[model samples]
Target: MTTVSVNLPATHYDVLIDRGLLDSVGSLVAKQWSPRKIALVSDDNVAPLYQERVAASLAAAGFDVHRYVFPAGEASKSLTVLAELVRQMAADTFNRDDSVIALGGGVTGDLAGLLAATYMRGLHFIQIPTSLLSQVDSSVGGKTAVDLDNIKNIIGAFYEPDLVIVDPNTLGTMTQRDLVEGYGEIVKTAALEGGEFWQLIETIDSPAELISNAPELSARSIHYKASVVMADETESGTRQLLNFGHTIGHAVEALANGALRHGEAVSIGTVAIMRVFEDAGLAEKGITSKLRDRFAAVGLPVTDPLLNSPQVLDKVKNDKKNRHGHLNLVYLTAIGHPEIKSIPSSEIASFLNLSVTN
Candidate 1:
């Protein structure tokens, strides 16, 4: 088992990663906080696979486990679903002494964590992220939210989990597209952490090879994320570096209307931003091409033909990263180094138009 500790001013927690860690989650949770009632939240897609095993484990550990399963997908992360969960917890007479366990992908973690953070003035929260995206990123960070008004994660809070158990074996059931989506985030993390890490990623040519090295890759990505979150827990400073591909990524994702996966959209967003930087002489020559080639090699999309530049620009106008109508974009002078620059929203729109034309 590989264990990484995230030490923060408010609380410190451990992220345990290994195959079959799911079966031992109950003992792990018991060590931290002995809850009389535990709410295990999962989605329909994931429930059939491991819900019983998780519930049985916790039941054996002497906790009253209540299973709450929602429909799978990003659509499930909403105010309505959150309200239902809150009502259910209330009906069960759950108190602050109870806990909530998120046992699925990013959506499950976000929704369940948000529920735990807000319910009963904040109950204990635990994460058992089953997806690669959640395992390496969302599962570690305290950022939790749900989609509202067609905007992604516009309504959310910073609520850390008491413990995070990541089992790589959960990823074996992921589809090819899901795995590719995860690689998009992994590639983005490697670019941010550059040097040896980037070199190591460059050597991995295929999705199969990447999955084969999931344990090392996930730990490295989580370590970088944990270090950044520790320095800036609230995303007021260095943590913004992690938004390398998300500014435009989120916008395009909304425009696609569920056609684009988060990681796939981010892959295209990374390439799009690099192209804009290259045009303005802000990034090194051939850097965009190199990134495009790398994304392609990993079966990630570098550009979406269905995306319209103007429509995407309209969506970016509402992105959370914008401050006072100015776009704050994270750009790379090269891999491993990211810079946040403020540009007029109009200028960003023009750049998106130019990227489409070129």
Candidate 2:
């Protein structure tokens, strides 16, 4: 069992990672809060798989478990769903003392976390991230939100979880595409983390090899992100480094409209931004090519036609990173080093129009 502590100013918590950890979640959560009403929030797809096991564990530990399962997909992350979940809890007579436990992938975690943060002002929140993307990235960060008008995470808040329980065993049932979806975020994060973390990912020659190392890789990714969150909890400073591929990635994701998974869009986004830097001579040549080779080896997309669409540029202008008419773009000088550059929102068209040789 590996435990990563996220020691922030206002909230301190532990991210426990281990196979078969799901069975022990009730006891683990009991250490944080006394047995109470637990709103076990899960998506329809995941509810049938492991929800019963989780709910049983919590029930056995003396907590009243209420199951709230919604349709599973990116489209489910919206105000309509959030309202429905919130209203359901209200109907059940829930209050501040109750809790919210997100029990699925990124979409589930993001939506449920927001439900916990906003319900009755705030409630004790717990995360049982099932997907690789959720387990490694979204599950740890306090960043939570729902999409608005095609903008990703446009409405959200920084609400840290009281406890995060990660069970890599849940990943065994994921489809290959779902597994690769996570590698996109892993690659982007490892690129920013650099050093030993980057080297560990580089050694993975295929999707099989990637999954084989998921337990250790997930721990390292969370550890790196926890440090960043502690330093810049509200993204006022260095935490923006975590947005490496997200600038263009979010735009691509919005344009793809569910055709691309979040991490897949991020995979293409990373290549596009690096190409812009390489073209400007701000980064060394061949770096973009290296990314292409590595990303392709793991079944990640390196480029997409929508990247050149005017609609994508329109989406870029609305990204959350934009401030005072400029948006911050994250690029790598090398595998282990990332730097942020702010560019005028007006100039994003040219960057999007630039050819990204995949």
Candidate 3:
């Protein structure tokens, strides 16, 4: 078992990682929270696979478990869905003493976390992140939100979980495409850290190898993210480094319109922005090539047709990171060295090498 502690100014939580950690979630959560009614929030896709096992574990720990399943997808992360879930919880007569457990991937975590944060002003929240994307990234961070319109994470809050339980075994059920999606985030994270970790990622040659090493890789990501969160919990400054590929990535994701997964879009976005860095001479010449090679090694796509779509430019205008007419983007001077640069909205096309009129 590997544990990463996110010691922040506001609160602290432990991200526990291992194979079969799901079986121990009830006991693990019991350490921090007392026995109470648990609203086990999950998606339709994830509910059948492991929800029964999870519910049994919670029952064994003497907690009343209530299952709430929703349609599984990015679309579920919205105010309308959030409101409906909240209304259900209210109908269930839930209150502060009860708890919320997120039992699936990123969408489940975001929805459940926000539900825990806002329900009756706040309820105990625990995360049992099933997907690799959630286990390694979204589950640990205090950021929780549902998408508003096309904007990602637009309506959310900084709500830390009381505990986070990660079971790499849960990833075994994922499709190859899902595995690649998770690796996309891992690649983005390793690119920012840029050293032995990056070298290790480069050494990984296949999806099987990635799954074999999921626990160690996830621990590294959690530790790295914890350090950043400790430094700037509210994303005031340094935490922006974590948004390494997200600037262009989010725009690509919005434009792809469900054709691409979030991590896949991020993989493409990272490649796209690295091209900008290379062209502007902000990064080494071969950096983009190296990144592309690594992504291809693990079946992650490095390019998407929508990456060059003019609609992407329009989407960038709605990005949450924009200040006035300038967008704050993470620029990689080299692997492991990241800097935040502000580009005027008009110049974004030039930054992306887009020929569209601004």
Candidate 4:
């Protein structure tokens, strides 16, 4: 078992990672606060697997619990679904004293967290992220949002959770593709941290092996994120480092129109941006080659077959990270070190063209 604490200016929370932490969620929530009602928000795919277990645990702990399940996938993370969740809570007379428990992947966590943050003027939020992607990244951070008009996370809030319980056992249900997609985020994190972490990741061959080594690797990733979030809670400064490949990644994701998974698109974006870094003389030679090999070994796609460079550029121009039409991109001079640079949106198209040609 490993515990990572996130200390912020407004509040502090602990992320507990272990093999069977889900069994102890009742006690964990009881220790925090006593609520009149609790809402368990999950997606349709995950509800059949773990929802009953989580709800049973919470119910046994002497709490009134209600379950709200939505259709699974990124498409569910929208205003219509969010509004429906809010309506359900209102119909149940749920007040601010109630709490919301997110029990699925990144999509569940994002939607439920937003529900908790806005319902009845804000309710307590707890995260029990089941997917590797959510457990390692989105579950810890306070960033919550749903896609607006196919633009990812354009509307959201910075509402922290009361506690995060990560049970590796839940990952046993994930498909190989889901697990591999998650490794993209793990590799991105390793690239940002560099040094021994990067070296360790370079040797990883499979997601199962990575999960077997989760205690050390997960802790390292979580601690790095905690440190960054602690330094810059609202993304005003240093926290931008976390968006290492997201500027390009999010654009590619939006362009895929739901065909590409978030991590998959990010994998392609990571390679594309690193190529740009190399061409600009900001990165060492052969860096892209090394990363491409590593990404391929882990079963991630290094390039987008359906990639349309012009459309990708258009999507990036509308990215939330852009400030008044200028893009602030996070680039790496080396593994584990990242810097933010501002470039004209027009220039990004040319840079990506160069990347695609090379």
- Stretches off by above 4 angstroms in model 1 are 351-353
Alpha-carbon runs more than 4 Å astray in model 4: none
Top lDDT model: 2
In the predicted model 3, the residue pairs found to clash are none
Greater lDDT among 2 and 3 belongs to: 2
Model 3 regions lying over 4 Å from their true place: 355-358
Against the true structure, candidate 1 reaches a TM-score of 0.96
Each model's lDDT comes to 0.87, 0.88, 0.87, 0.85
lDDT of 4 by residue, 70-130 (tens): 9999999999999999999899999877889999999999999999888877999999999
Screening candidate 2 with a backbone cut-off below 3 angstroms (N, C-alpha, C), the clashing residue pairs are 194-336
Candidate 2 lDDT for residue 232:
95
**Which candidate, 1 or 4, has the higher lDDT?**
1
- Whole-model lDDT for model 4 versus the true structure? 0.85
In model 1, what is the error at residue 135, expressed in angstroms? 0.8
lDDT of 3 by residue, 1-358 (tens): 8888988777888988989888887788778878899999999999999899999999999899999999999999999999999999989999889999999999999999999999999998999988999988999878899998777888999999988998899888999998779888898888888888898998999999988989988998888888999999998889988988887788888887888898888888888878877877888889888888888998898887776578887787667888789888886787888888889988887676662111
TM-score of 4: 0.97
